[model samples]
Target: MALSSQTTALAQIPRVHIFPTAGEAADAVAEHLLATVKRNPKSVLGLATGQTPRHVYAKLVHAFREGKISFCDVETFNLDEYCGLTASHPDSFAAFMQRELFGLADFDPRKTNLINGDVQDVVAEARRYATRLKESGAVDVQLLGLGTNGHIGFNEPGSASDSHVRVVDLADETLSANQPSLIELTSVPERAITIGIADILHAREIVMLATGSAKAGAVRRSLREAPSTDCPASFLGTHQAVHWYLDNAAAAEIG
Candidate 1:
C-alpha cells in the first residue's frame, strides 16, 4: 500500500518530510517542538528514547542553553522501560533518557516521569502513571522513535490497539535489536512496562523520528502498512496530528 493510502485522513497527517541526514531531521523537529513549548510554557510532553531521538535531544539542549527554550514549565512522561531493571541500570530506559535528554537540558527531576521498572507493584505503578497523565491534562506533543520491529513505546507485535498501561513480554526480536550490547538473543528480558496506545493517542500532536538504513524497512511499513497492531507505528497515521521526520537512509524505501 502507498503511504498516503494507508490511512483515511491524509489531510490531517500533519506534515511528512525527509532530510539529507538525521541531524537535519532533528533540527527541524526540535525547532517545531521548542516553538510549541515556547508558545505554551507549561506544555506537557511525551518523550521517547533510542538512537533516532538523540540528535533531537541534543538540539533541544542547545536551545535550552542558548535561551531559546526553557524546561522550567515543562512536564514530561516517558514511553516505556524494561520490566526488571532499576533507574540506574546502564541499559535501563530511565538512564538512557536522563543521559541523552533530561540531564543535558537540566530538566527538573520532579517534572519528568518515567515508568519505574523496579516498582514492586507493577500494576499499581502503571495505574498511577495513567492517573498522573490524566491529571496533567494529557500530552501536548509526543516524540517517538520506531523499533526495527515496528513497535512503538514497547507496543510490540500483536499489541492491541487499545492496550493501556501495563506490563508485557518484550518480543525477543525487539529486545535483541534494541540493546544488543547488553542483551543477547537468549538473555533478552521477557517483560517490559509501557504506556498504552490510548495514552499515546491522547496527545494533541505526535512526532516520530527515524534514522539509519536499519530502520528503513520498518519506516516503510509504518507509513504504508494497514493500521493494525502488528505494525504498531502504523497507528500514528490514524492519529489526529502526526508528523514523521526521516533521514534519507531511513526513508530509502518510501518509493
Candidate 2:
C-alpha cells in the first residue's frame, strides 16, 4: 500500500470525502458541479456515464428545473463510448447521457461532444475527439466513476500512463461488470473509444465517485496502492487536485 516513487513525487495527497449514504455523496458532487458552472457559465465539463452518475445527473436535472442552474452555455465531453454503437443506440453512452442528463437539462446539443463509437475508423475518431477537447481549453471539472477493476474511462489495466484518446479492447472484467447494465444488447461490447488517462489528468479538476460495497476493494487499491497500469485509477493519485467522493460502503476497504 506504500506510494510508488513516481506517485509520491507528483501527488499532493488527494482529498477523500466520505458520506453517510450514496444519495448524500451524490448531493455533494452535484453542489460542487453547480459551483463550477456558476463560476464559469461557459465551463467545459468532462462527464461520465454509468449507474454511479445517475443520481448526480438526476440532481442536476432537478437543479435545472428549479431555476438554480442552466447548461445552455456549458459545453460537455463524455469520457468514453462503446464501439459499434451509434449515438442513438439505446445502450450507447450518448443515449445514456440524453436519457439521464442532456435530455432533461438546458444543455445545447451542438456544444455537447461524444466519441463516434460506431465510426468506420476509430483511430481517426479518437484524434478528432482529442482535437475538439484541446480546442475547448481545459475542462473545468472532470467527473468520473470507478470501475470494479480500477479503470477510469475505459483506460483499462495495462494502459500506458501517457496514453491519450484511443480505441481500446475492453478487459473481460470490464465486460462482465457492465453486462447487467445493458437491457437492449444481448452481448456486451468488447471495445470502447475512450479519452485516455493522460487526457483525464490534464483536466483542471477531477471528481471521482464510488458507492456500494461492490467498489470497496477497487477504492482501497486506487487510494492505497502505488501508481501502476495494473490499476489505472491508481494513477489519479498523481493528480494534484483530484477529489474522491465515496459512500461509507465504498470507503469500507480504504482504511
List the global CA lDDT of all models: 0.82, 0.90
The local distance difference test score of model 2 is: 0.90
Could you tell me which 10 consecutive residues in candidate 2 have the lowest summed lDDT?
1-10
Q: Write the per-residue lDDT of candidate 2 for residues 32-112, one digit (tens) a residue.
A: 899999988999999998899999999999999999988999999999999999999999999999999999989999999
Instruction: State how far residue 13 of model 2 sits from its true place (Å).
Output: 6.8
Taking all chains together, each candidate's TM-score versus the true structure is: 0.89, 0.94
Off by over 4 Å in 2: 1-14
Compute the lDDT of residue 88 as modeled in candidate 2. Answer: 94
Model 2 residue-pair collision total: 0
Show how many residue pairs clash in every candidate, following the order shown. Answer: 0, 0
lDDT of 1: 0.82
Give the Å shift of residue 118 in candidate 2. Answer: 1.7
**Candidate that scores best on lDDT:** 2
Q: After superposition, how far is residue 86 of candidate 1 from its true place, in Å?
A: 1.7
